[model samples]
Target: VGRYLVQLPRGALSAHDDALRRAGIRVRRGGAVLGAGGKASLGPLSPARRKPPSSSPRLDAITLQEQLERALRERQARPTGICPVREALHGALLEELAGTIARDEPRRGTLLRRVAGEARMTIDAYRTVYEKSLLFGASKLSEAAALKGNLEGRIAELQAETASLADEVRSLTDLCESLEHRAQRAEAQAEAETHDASALRAEGEQLQGLLDALRPG
Candidate 1:
């Protein structure tokens, strides 16, 4: 009903206001609708006033019930359409229903109170469970996020260390290659020196034989 009023065009709402006024309901600011005798109209869009249940009214249940039936019959007789008159009739019907309930509730008040108390307790229990679950889930999510960050940091450190080790390995490999080339050259020079020494020794022996052959002995 509040949404209906809010969405209504200004012109249409004005018309509704007039109809509601004729029906003894005043449309107040903030979507409050006060019916005759200062009773607040009950609706999803209306804020309900908190009041203790009253003692049953002096009115006879049968008489009030007849009036309620008559009002319902009158409302059903009207043509259905989106109009101020229809809205007025609907509000009047609701007032009749509320009046009937208020007048009749005393007879069943005890049972109603007990049921209401049980319902409140049930709602509170569910709310507590839901809040605990939500907190637990949030805590677990925070922990998981922290763990993921730590693992990522560790992985980054390992990758940097691996790169450094690879650089050292390359340096050692280059040094080893240079030393191998030097060793090969040394081996070649040693072989040439050996050949030269062998040739000189042979020549010395041959010259000694030539001198002996040339000497008269």
Candidate 2:
């Protein structure tokens, strides 16, 4: 009379209970079942099941495995000219592997290994394609690292060039300011000289008028 608590869907529980009864194992369907010593045999079951409501949502383990394999095969079947899609597939595979590795489930390592094997197979098949399109013989990760390094270097060079150009602009701006200041001073001096010349001409006109008056009288 060993009691085993099985948590499953209502339908699944009914099926299991029927099966256990057929095997001569005692099973009771209620809120909680206790063991032989009157200790609680089963923990509290959440009313909500972990799985989706749909009985057949096409997310079975076999279907998922098949889909993953099919995707890998399709990617392998592509022509070498289709490098972008191949690279995209490779990236997707890598990301899936990372996600699988991050999962806390006991089967996470197994899933990751399966995905890694599939990715490796696809990568082997697309090696030639990558060499042709990516123009490098290295693996995708290596190529990515190299591309990143090259971009960083180019960015640094561009930044340095931008700084130099900014300095040049600042120098030009300062020079323009100095020229403007000198121009303002020259304009003020010219205005003062014109005023002095006008005063001298007026005095000479007055002297000439006096000399003419004295001569005529």
Candidate 3:
């Protein structure tokens, strides 16, 4: 029963199998199902994946066959223009798996190449968008840096101006002290003049009394 189940259609896989089934050709092959470079559920790595450079997983016959089948499916479904562009570029990266796949599945190099080509175009389109985004970001960063420099310059100017104002304040304080000293001297001089005038009046009054006494004698 297990053997029969294993031999049953592994679930709609290939066009050839579909044609065969239509023609009453019943065959069931055991292995991973193939689709684009994604979905471990389908047993194909996500078509858009980040793998270490120079990293390729070892492939067995079953695995290679499944990978090839997936590439074929993805090729047929290639879009006219991969939208958002970034995902397209990612597809290109995953397409490198074709090279790894060919090492083990050399029998299907032609199919792998087709998959790689489609991924390449998608990636190329994405690269254009990626490059534009980088340029725009760099321009914005430059503007921010320039603004920062200007702010620093303004701060320096304000600090220098503040120092100059402080110096002016000190000078004004000294001038005020000098003016107060001069005012104190003027007040002292005025008091001395008043005392001298009173002394002169007293001396004149004593002289008048002496004159009257001499007249009476």
lDDT of 2 at 46: 32
lDDT score at residue 114, model 3, on the 0-100 scale: 86
Indicate the TM-score of model 2. Answer: 0.38
Query: Which lDDT values do the candidates have, in the order given?
Result: 0.64, 0.64, 0.63
lDDT-best of 1 and 3: 1
Tens-digit lDDT track of model 2 for 1-217: 2223456555555545545556665443345443433333543233221222234435444665676568767767465555556566656656544554455453775777777779777876777676676655456778789999999999999999999999999999999999999999999999999999999999999999989989955
The C-alpha TM-scores of every prediction are 0.43, 0.38, 0.41
Please provide, for model 1 over 1-217, each residue's C-alpha lDDT reduced to its tens digit, 9 standing for 90 to 100: 1222233433455556656767765554445455654554654433333222334434445655676567657666445423344545545544444544545585455555555567657866876897898899999999999999999999999999999999999999999999999999999999999999999999999999999999998
Q: Compute the lDDT of residue 211 as modeled in candidate 2.
A: 93
Q: Which stretches of candidate 3 lie over 4 Å from their true place?
A: 1-133, 215-217
Clashes within 3 Å, all models in order: 0, 0, 7
Candidate 3: worst-modelled 10 consecutive residues by lDDT: 34-43
- How far residue 192's Cα lies from its native spot in candidate 2, in Å, is 0.8
lDDT of 3: 0.63
